[model samples]
Target: MARASATPRSSAYLSALSQEIEKKLQRALASPPQRRNLLQELFADVALEVDDRARDIILSREEDTISPADDSHLGQLCFYDVLADYYVQAPESGKPILDLIVQLWSQSFASHIFSLLFHKWLFEVQLDNPEVLLRYSSALAQGATNVFWIDIQTNTRRFQSLFCYLLDEVAVEPARLNKIPVQAQRDLYLLLSRFILFYNSGDKLDTFLKHCPTFPNAFLIGGPTDFFVTELADQLQKLKVEPVLLHYLSNLKVLQGMELRMATSTRLKTCLYSFTSPGGPMYPTRAVRHAAWDALDLLFPLFDWRSRTLHPVYSAHLQRRSTA
Candidate 1:
């Protein structure tokens, strides 16, 4: 009877302990040493249970139902609240702590780490707020772009699958894009566009782009030689986002080189030169041309395609290769 009573008492004690720790975490996360050190203390005190409880708190919602705001709070609090400022104030001391959290949490609870970082990136920088986006894009554009790349680099398959899962969740049925808010739709569009534009140089980025759903391989590979550009062109036609589509394709052409095989289509070839064939060329407006050239110039130095021809540099090279 005494032992039975002790068991309930122990249960109650642990429950109280958990509540105390949670309350402390909420408060502690708001400040400095507490912001960083409290996490360490929690790890020491609660050990692996920290992962379980934190994961449960974070993953409480169905993945599809979770919003950027939901996933962003902790990361925003940690970075924008005081910790990042602390890092700025004392890089030598604070950098290690911030780095440790990013490293250890990533290793231990990758999904949670990814959720925090990805949504933080979206909510902080990738939102439809023009002022915020422009400021962030100017201040730390590379860092903003690196957020997605770093997550993918951390664990290729996991992050890729996670991204696809998130995409599926946001892609509501029937109404499709109309299901997401107009702002959210624009933000999502920017996210995709930035992925194409910013990370256009690396091999992993190339492989990622080639395989991503927007350029799915099954539809791309094993088709006719002339069909490569057409496949993407047709897909873009269906989506009807002509400006974004043309600009993205131009970035891919510059980055991927002959890999895109845009010259394979004779009609596409002519349109590439004229840049004014409204009836046939997808890039009908000057705005679309400028956007494409902007992406190209950003990635490639002195990339004045007007003074020179892309066909001489890229298309001619592509023509020599055997289609088989």
Candidate 2:
């Protein structure tokens, strides 16, 4: 029964997969005219199925998977490539077209979106691979660090082995990011922005804080709190990234009358006012503990921890939510 046919893993996988396919299809459009035309024709049917709402989902989901060469995007050239219409056509507004598309798609497709998305991405990855997808054995694993934000209630520790594997194995290469084409960079930024919203992912708060200023792909990067801060997290630092963490979290905290303290070398002995809500918006109380954790990230990642210390003045802010 359609009513009973919903599961988190299946849905998340599909959403992730759809994004990969969209990315590959866009990349493929840059090839020779003959191939380009062929690809466009192939997707013409898919394009036809996409109305305004479908357009939004396909465009936003398209960029999450950026290939080394974008061979997958060859799915472009279709009379109605979602990417073609949004990025190629839409002008820069206060909000980008990509964001607009995904927001629109979420209204009706919420239930089936992720599962449908995962299938699209899997097929796209296997399109070039004659073999079954050996790559995605770890794709879900790649997303492991991000699971915390997916549903905080889910036990994240269960996936530790997979996270270790990613650390030991596959991840974003610092070198290749530069070699990426401009279109890809643009596409990814939009994709990241939208997916963060779709996932209701707070993990990106760290990503926003780290890369929002230059968040190349709003949807692509995750905030610091996300345990997924592996190579990609550090690799992004190589470029100028925009940190949007405070902005989003501040908004959330405002509702709960909470205060946020970014990690710094300073201590918070002089600080006051605790964000009482345990899981409403803010996190566990231990300011001294969280501040120390942030300082470690800021000062010496490899150095020892100092239990007794109060240094520079810690910077922090507070907010309350809208009564309306």
Q: Which of the numbered candidates is closest to the native, going by highest lDDT?
A: 1
Residue-by-residue lDDT tens digits, candidate 2, 1-324: 001121333234334534654543444333444444433443333333344443333333232432212212323222122232222222231123223223322222211222222322332222334222333222322233233123223311222222222221122222322233334333333334322322344443443424322343334333322212222222222211122222222323211211323321111211111222234233434442243234333433332347443333322221221110
- Assess each prediction's global lDDT (C-alpha) against the native: 0.36, 0.29
CA deviation > 4 Å runs, candidate 2: 1-104, 108-112, 119-148, 157-283, 286-310, 314-324
lDDT of 2 at 63: 29
How do the residues 1-324 of candidate 1 rate in per-residue lDDT, one tens digit apiece?
000111233334434543554454555445654555655454334322224443343234442343222323223212121212222223343323333344433232222332423332333222466654443332222333344555333322222322332343332221343433444443443344344332233233333333232323435442322333443333334323554445444655443344334344433433333332233445446555454344433434333567764534344433322220
Q: Candidate 2: TM-score?
A: 0.24
- Model 2, residue 256: displacement in angstroms? 32
- Scored by TM-score, the top model is 1
Return the TM-score for each candidate structure.
0.28, 0.24
Provide backbone clash counts, one per model: 0, 45
Model 1: lDDT of residue 271: 33
Tell me the deviation in Å of residue 34 in model 2: 44
